[model samples]
Target: MRAVETGKKPVLSAEIFVIPIEADRFLVYAPLRRAAFVGNAGAVNFLADLREGRGDSGAGHDGEMIEFLRRLEIVDAGPETPPLAVFSDDPNPVSVTLFLTTACNLRCAYCYAAAGEGAARHMPPELARRGVDFVVGNALARGEDHFEINFHGGGEPTRNWPTLTKTLAHARRLADAHELRLTAYLATNAVLSAKRLDWVVANLHGASVSCDGPPEVHDANRVTPGGKGSSASVIRTLRRFDAEDFPYGIRMTVTADAIPRLADSVEYLCANFRPGQIQAEPAYPIGRGAGAASAETAAFVAAFREAQGRARRHGRELTFSGARVGTLTNHFCAATQDLFALTPDGSVSSCYEVFEESSPRAKIFLYGASAGAGGGWRFDREKLAFLRRQSVDRRAHCAGCFARWSCGGDCYHKALTVHDDGEFAGTDRCDIIRELTRDQILARIADSGGVFWHEPPERIAAEGCACVSCGDEGRIMTGRGVKKPDRGCV
Candidate 1:
C-alpha cells in the first residue's frame, strides 16, 4: 500500500466507492459532497470491491483501511475557486422610491399611479418625513454610508410641494446626523415653474420627465384628467428647465398607440430636448393601460434601434438600462435588485409596480427599524430571500441564459402580470434586448475594424437570436449538435 498521509476528515461520509480491478490503487466516494477520487496504491482492489458491496466481505477484508480512509480529507484540484463574498455582501443597499403623492395635475392615461380623482391616497408631509428618516436610519445601522431616495408621484410630484420640501429637508438632516450620504431624485411631468425648478435643483440631484417623443406623440399619450393635451405645457416646462441647465433625463413609455410612430417619436425627442439620457419602458399591463402587444413591442424596439443610430449620427450618446448586448446578452433589469421603491408610508418595494397592494411580490416591505427611536425602520430580509428564491427558482430557463448575470431577468412585475409567474418566461422582451445589443456590438465591431476580443458571449447570442427564433434551450446547436456555439453564443 502506498504510504498516504491523512488529515482532518470531512464531516459527511460517502455511500459508494469505486476501485480499479487491475491496479493496487482504489477510489473513495463522498456522495454527500458530490465528490470521488483515487486513493493510495497500497489498498487491494478486491478490498475496494468488497467495501463497495461487489465481493465477499470476508475475502479481502481490511477493517482498519475503511476507517483510515474515512478519516482522511479529500483535497480539491479543480480550477474554479469560490468567490470571496456572496451576492448579499454587496455594499449598495437596494434603492427605494417614495411617491409622496398620487395627485398629479396631468392625466397621462397610462399613469400607473392611477392619480387624479380616484387614485390611491396621497402621503402627508409627516408621513413622508417619517419614511425618509426610516430609510436613512436603517441604512446607517447597516454601515451603509450612502442611500438613494427617489421621489416619484401618481400625478405631478411638484403638486405636493409641501410634502416634498419637508421630506427632502428631513432626509438631509437625518443624513447629516447619522453621518450618511443621501441622494435625492424626482420623476415628474415637468409642469412646474421657475420657483419649483429652483427648489428641485437645490434639493434633488436629478430629475426625470415624461415625454413620448415629439409634440404629437407626447400630446397623444399625455393629457390632463380633463382630457386636455399636455404636450405644449410639458415641452414649455422642459425647455424652461433645460435653459436653466437643470440636470434631467427624458423618460418615455412606449405603448401600442405610440409604436406606429416609434422612429418619429425618437427623432422628436432628439430634436426637441437633447436630454442627458433617454429611458424607454414598454407600457405595462396594469392600472388604466395594460401590457403592449408583442407586435407593438417589436415595432418599438426597431424604432428605438433607428433612434440609437440617429443619436449616433448626431454624435449624441444613447444608453439602455436593461438592454441586451449582442446575441449573447440579456436585458439588464437593474431595478429588480439594484434599485428599490419606497412608498410614502415607508413601505419598501422592488419597484413602483410592486407598491401596488394587489401585487403578489409587494408583500416584501421595510416597515421600520428597531435601532431607531421615534420611528420604526426595517428591511424585511425574509421577504427579500423569498423574492430572490422566486427569481432563481421559477426562472430556471434564465439560469442557462447568457444574459443571466447582467439582465437579472427583466421586470418581476411584468413576469408576474404577463406570464402569471414572478419569474421571467420566454417572451418578446428577449427579442427586444437581443436586437438592441446586436446593433451595439455591430457598431462597436465596425468601429474597431472587426478585430475585437473580450466581446461578451451573451451579447453575441443576443445578436444571433435577434435574426431568427433561437429557441430557449440555452444552447445554440448546428447540425446534429456536432458543433455548438459558446455558452454565450446565439
Candidate 2:
C-alpha cells in the first residue's frame, strides 16, 4: 500500500530482489511489476531507507534514486501479477498424451522410468482407440475443430510399434471422418530401425528425440539390451531426420559424467545436426539412476551456460526445464494443468514419471482410469482439485523468489520426491534455477539495450537474441520444464 509522496517521505512499494554482481553493483529487480536494473550499493541503501520509512525527502542524491525507481514503477506500482487461475469444473482436456508402453529398445543409465527393467507392459489398442474416441468426441462437442494426441515415454513409445502405428491410423480416420484436425507428436530415444524411422517420419507430425551428444558420451549411458552402444542407431535416426527435413527437437540429458562434456556435446550437436530446439537437463536421481550422483549441481549450471552460448552461435537455443526467465505463469507444467496422459493399462497420470499403478506416488498423480469398454473415464475429482492447487502462488517457498513467476515453481513431481510427499520445500534445483534465470534476465536486458528491461510479449521473451536456451514455445520452463508431453522424457 506504500507509494511515493510529493512532500511526505517517499516509500518503497514493490518487493525488490537485490542480486549482487560486484562488490558495489547489484541487479535490482521488481518481479511482479516486471522491472529491473543494475545499481550501486548507495542506490540499494536509498531504497532500504524508503522501505524502513526513513527515505530522505530532501531533493538531493537520494531524491534522484527515488525518481529513478518511480520511473521503473518500483516506487509506487501495485503487484500487476495475478494469482494463478484454477479449474474447479470437471476436466475436459482436448489433448491426450498416451504413454504407449514400458518396453524401451535402449537402456539409458539415468532413465527416470527405468523402462525395460520391468517385464514390459504394452497399452492395448482398444485403450488407444477409446482414448482417441474420447478426445475426438470432446473436440467435436466443444467445437475445438482440432485435438492433439501425443505419444510420450513411460518407455520408448516406438517399441510398441504395432499399437503405436495403428493408433495414429485410427486417429487419422477419426480426423478425416469428422473433418477435424488432428495433431500427434512422439517422445523417443531415437534408436530406430529403417522401417520405424521411415514410419515416424511419414506418419507423425513431430517428435522429441533423446540424444546425449557424441558417441562416447551417449554410449557411456544410452546402451542396448546386449550392452552395445545405441549411439550409432540414434545418429542414423538423426541423419534420416535431417535428410527428410523432419520437424523435431533434440533432448540431451547431462549426467554427472556428462557435465564436463555438456558444452562439447552441445557444440557437437549444433555443428553436426540440425534440430529446431535443443533442451538439456541435469540427470535427477530416479529409476535406474536412483542414488546415482546427481548432475544437478553448480558444475552443471556452469556447463549449461557455456552450452547455451554455443547453441546461440548455431542459431539454436540450449535449454533446461527449470530456468526459464521472461515467462510468466503459475504452474510449472502440465501435471498441474490437467494433462490427460493415459498409462499403459488405460489408467490416467498427470505426471510422466509416475506411469505405473504401483508407483509409490500413484495415489497423488494417477487421478483417473478407463471405465472399461463402453464406459469412458472416471477421474477422482478430489485428486484433480489437489493437482490444480499446486500452482506457484500457493507455494510459500516461492513467495519471495524473483524467478517464481518465470520458473513457475519448478517441478511438482521432483518436489514430491525431494520432500518425500510432504510439504513443499525448495530443492537443489533452486540454486540452478536462480542462476540460469539470472543469466537470462541479464541477457534480456543486454538484448533490449542492457541499461534496463521491463516487460515484453512472451514471444519476445522466449525468442530474440538472448543466450539462454530455456524457452518452450514461449511457455514457462521449470524443473523438467513442467510442460506438455510432446517434449522428450528420459
lDDT for model 1, please.
0.52
lDDT of 2 by residue, 258-308 (tens): 999999999999999998888888887998899999888999999998999
Reference-based lDDT, each prediction = 0.52, 0.77
The 10-residue segment of model 2 with minimum total lDDT is: 465-474
**Cand. 1 TM to true fold:** 0.68
Per-residue lDDT tens digits for candidate 1, residues 308-402, read 77776666655444443422222222232323444554465544554445445455433222234466445556665544443322468765443
Worst 10 residues of 1 by lDDT: 466-475
- Find the number of clashing residue pairs for candidate 2: 6
lDDT of 2: 0.77
**Which portions of model 2 show Cα errors greater than 4 Å?**
1-13, 53-64, 457-490
Question: What CA root-mean-square deviation does each model show from the true structure?
Answer: 14.9, 4.4
